[model samples]
Target: MEVLSLKVNGDTRCLAAAPQATLLEVLREELGLTGCKQGCDKGDCGACTVLLDGQPVLACLTLAALVQGREITTIEGLAPAHRRRCAESPCASKQDKLHPVQDAFDEAGALQCGFCQSGMILSATALLQRDDDPKRETIREALSGNLCRCTGYTQIIEAVERASDEHAGREHRPRAWEQPATEPAGEGES
Candidate 1:
């Protein structure tokens, strides 16, 4: 067993893991951070995405021991990170916070089945950190690595746009899904 010291979610965590154990196993099994889903177990699926030094990486493809002393941020850490950033602001609240991206995802109905959300959210978070006002195509490219079997990318893209708008201090446009569907002109009323 290899003893690894990992700085995760603003905390230092030391644990014993197999030499070949992936970060996904260490995070989910050892650290009990299941938010980084274990899907495909290969690099193809971004379900194991996590932030390594603020860049999104696939945890399943990363060896736990190789990341010693590096900053690791999982989905569970996002809200706490936001809370810390807003600590001195009046907007800071005592209640647990959701990262803006997470909130947007929820409000935009971007989640379904929820298997791919953590990775998607993390990807979006990283993207927003780099570009607060990303265009729709940019958002799509940024999240292209993460796959969502349920939302069909539309709601997810809208969620990213909403978060971007919120960060840029712009009014959030309602997501397409959030807009009430217009009834077909009443059959006789054309």
Candidate 2:
């Protein structure tokens, strides 16, 4: 087994993995981060999307050992809960805020079964990074890679549009904790 160190979900972790293990296996079986699900296990599905150096990537095709000394973000890392997770904590960092794409997804009611939600969100993040506000056709082009089996795509597409609007306005709230559940445990606004 090789000891590979990676930054996952903002935490640096060293894990023991097989030299030839796929990132998916190491994530689901070894590290127990099941949010990155297995769909096609090939690059086609885009279901196992995660961020590599802040960009969306397919986890199944990535090599586990290759990510050492680099950052690997998984679905668990992108959840809305984390945006406000430590918001109230005394040690909260400014980056604790969710990416604007997440807030847009929530505002647009874009998810159905929520199966393709994470990949969709990350892809949108990547798309938005290149453009301040993308047109519907542009958003459609950006999301072409991710698949939604539930045909929940209409809502998903709308969510991206809504995200663009919210992001422009700067009042985006991650769907989770939109109305903080009576305030974060340790938060005091900076």
Give the Cα lDDT of each candidate: 0.88, 0.78
Q: In candidate 2, which residue pairs get closer than 3 Å at backbone N, Cα or C atoms, i.e. clash?
A: 88-186, 88-187, 104-163
Report residue 71 deviation for candidate 2 (angstroms): 1.7
True lDDT of residue 169, candidate 2: 81
How many residue pairs clash in each candidate at the backbone level? 0, 3
Enumerate residue pairs that collide in model 1. Answer: none
TM-scores for every predicted model: 0.83, 0.77
On residues 1-190, what C-alpha lDDT tens digit does candidate 1 reach at each position?
A: 9788999999999999999999999999999999999999988879999999999999999999999989999998988765766765877664446778888988899988899999999999999999998877778789998988774688889889999998899998743334546878656844
* Poorly placed runs, candidate 2 (over 4 Å): 79-83, 87-99, 170-190
Which segments of model 1 are wrong by more than 4 Å? 81-96, 174-190
